[model samples]
Target: MSDTTTVGPDTAGIGRTRTPTPFRRLLAVETRKLFDTRSGKIMTAVMVVLTVGAIAGRGLYAGPRLEVLIGTAGLSLGTLLPVLGILTVTGEWSHRTALTTFTLEPRRGRVLAAKCLPPLIAAVAASAFAILVAVPVTAAVSAVRHVPADWDLTPVALLGWTAANVLVVAMGLALGMLLLNAPAAIVICLSAPALWSAVARIGSVGETLAGWLDLNTTAGPLMEGHMTGGDVARLAASVSFWIVVPLATGTARVIRKEIG
Candidate 1:
């Protein structure tokens, strides 16, 4: 004899319980986490340091030339900004705080999105901050260098750089989610480009591998506004790799693995 019973939608097994979508939940948590930490404070401090340094360095060293000062200032701080991007997403996993995050959210995808959004937002904010600080610095430098106040804040350049920063941050987030190991992900994100560049410089398999490796030669044109046909193809392939593969791999892990 078989007993058959049908349960209402609300009475379904725990597995069938409707959950908050991962996107909104993750975004809130990620943003909250950024503001609650010493790292966030450190990032703020770095920005201030760059602002002051740009003003002083251009004024004292570069004869206060606006373009020279702005370009030099940007070169100094640009690399660290990307590092900040990497840390934002990787910090949770590195600190093992993701356990708490996952337990609360239960939806892995939402948590991942939340983790990503803050850093991406921060990158845009950084770009604007750079422009703001540069404005005053450019004036100071122009005064020092006796140059005309012909400072150019190319809108296209600003927007392009900001977008590039956001994309790189997103790439870091994707890598973090995929690796689930903070140090490893950070190393890969940082080193991958360097390694590819070095290999590409050599005239061997490295050159071939360079073209195949995404995020180095591939992403350069996308950011720099000089993408050729080969560059565009490589960049597309690289973007696809980061956007698709890491997400797929990470989502599977989040769904199947124990949260804590």
Candidate 2:
């Protein structure tokens, strides 16, 4: 027998490093996490229920005008998507999973990117789904009530509606990232519009500032597809202040903060 034993193939590769996860995989994981948690699942369910109820209510009582149906569904989705975004970012901290997440990924910016992408996609999907559901319901209501089924939604209006919902979702993500605490993030996200509305009522100067800085006001024209050049300018300014600034600040903070 030989005095020395030969090294095995498995042992020879022991020092080899594993590959980092691809961005696509990261996005998929983040998307799945949105629905995997108990709270995520519950919130999603509530959103769906509210959307269906709103559409159905419109069909039954109010005229199932396509615009009204879209607006109602959009409102429900807008209300809930932010909560979903907040929980998505904060849940890692709340559940003490940040340590593991950072350990595995080691790049906080990529993690944040992963977290942000899902909500935007979800918002677009939810908006489309609402439109799809409304079509059949509107037809049924029109037939029963002998009203014309107005399928007169223009491309611009549809695009604007989707864009408005996406902006709201982005706002929620920005707020969530900025606060990093679920309750505080959620409260601020919900109350900021109302607070700004109060501020806007103070004076002409306040109104002018709000017109440019308040997303609730600036984004309203988008839903109606009636944005003028001024409306577009105001929307841009408001999004820059609310979404861009906070996201930049939050990304820096998250990158620097030590994971416990």
Candidate 3:
């Protein structure tokens, strides 16, 4: 045997190694994490329960006032979807599985995009489910309670609302990445709307500004068939704030940050 071991080329150390099936592999892994967690399961259950409860409540309790019934449906949509959005992103951070996620997909942007895909799919499904539940439930409730539960189901408005929700889920994912703490992100998502409403109570300018910033206020147009120019502007701005800004910031951070 030779006393000295044969040496490989030192140049081999200088080249970059590449992941073979990076995005595809990362997408699967990220999606699996969503289904595997207790938090994700709990959130899913809560979503189903809340959804069914909204249907039942609307069917049983909605009285003669069509506006009240419509308001109830809209509010229910607002509450449940945002909660779903919050959980979609925050679960990973809450479980400390971000380590495994980031580790597997060292390219954080790709990982974030992967994480977003499942929730976007869920949002579409949830939107259609909401409409399905609302229609039959409203019909039954209107008949039994002797209430006029009437509204036009504009396909364009429905599509807009569905897209809005998908964007909301994306926003939640971005918030999660930006905060890296589940509870904080949840609190922010929950409180921000309430805070905007409170500020809206102050004065005219404050109210106007709040209407611009408050998702609750902005959501009215999309929920209804109004779709006025101002409403469209506010909705656009709100979507941009949550979906665009946070995503850009989070992607930048994830790209540059040191991973463990």
Candidate 4:
């Protein structure tokens, strides 16, 4: 040590920095987590079974018109998909994994984005699955009923159905993130529409507001693939209230709230 005191060789850089986990890796983990739990697996199985059963039932009675088949499956999926999204978020807290998750990925927003994307993907897949199932069912029903199979679903109708499912799942994710409690999130998500429907039926003023802000009314046309410009405007308003506000507020809370 002639000129300078000996220092540890570049130790400053060794422990001071860590490469952040890749976003794609985080997304893959989140996607797997969606089906890794017992409840999650059960819920997924139930959704698939119900979708198949609903389509089959319609084939038996209503003669599996493509619209009827898709509509029936969409109804079942719309209800269940949201529940799936809700569980994806609430389970992190319920299972006491949020602390670890935040520790591994300090940026909570990325985590939330990761959580949101998979459900939307699932929603799209569910719609596609329904369509696949409908094809054979439509064929069988047309044969049995001695009627022409109506595979006349336009691209617009298909797009609308897919969008509707995604919106419902988004609403669920927003509510789950906002509440961070599975029971509360599920309850509110289920009841709010009914409550709004009741309020909408009360008076003309209420009806007018609901016409714009009620997702049930606005999103209904999407399933039928008959959205007008007015319907699009109303859907945007309803989604802003139900999905955007809650998701934004919930994300902010998650970012700042103390993790236990």
TM-scores, one per candidate: 0.76, 0.92, 0.80, 0.93
Q: Compared with the true structure, what per-residue lDDT tens digits does model 1 show for residues 1-260?
A: 76988766784576786666557656776687776788777776877687667667666765644445555545534555555656776676678776877777776666666666777787788767766776776676667667766555456656665666666677776776677666787687767777778788889787877785656557656545565788778766776787568867876775676635
- lDDT tens string, model 3, 133-169? 6777777777887767676556676776776666656
The positional error of residue 241 in candidate 3, measured at the CA in angstroms, is 2.9
Ten-residue stretch with the least lDDT total in model 1: 64-73
lDDT of 4 by residue, 135-171 (tens): 9999988888889898888888889889999999999
Runs of candidate 4 with Cα error greater than 4 angstroms are: 1-15
Clashing pairs in 1: 22-110, 26-114, 27-114, 64-141
Off by over 4 Å in 1: 1-26, 51-78, 149-153, 211-216
- Candidate 3 — what's its lDDT? 0.69
Candidates' lDDT values, in order?
0.67, 0.88, 0.69, 0.90
Which is better, 1 or 2, measured by lDDT? 2
Ranking by TM-score: 4, 2, 3, 1
Q: What lDDT is reached at residue 242 by model 1?
A: 73
Q: Please report, as a residue range, the 10-residue window in candidate 3 with the lowest summed lDDT.
A: 62-71
Candidate 3 stretches greater than 4 Å from native: 1-19, 63-77, 142-151
Kindly give the stretch of ten consecutive residues in candidate 4 with the minimal lDDT sum.
8-17
Best of the candidates, TM-score: 4
Model 2 regions more than 4 Å off: 1-17
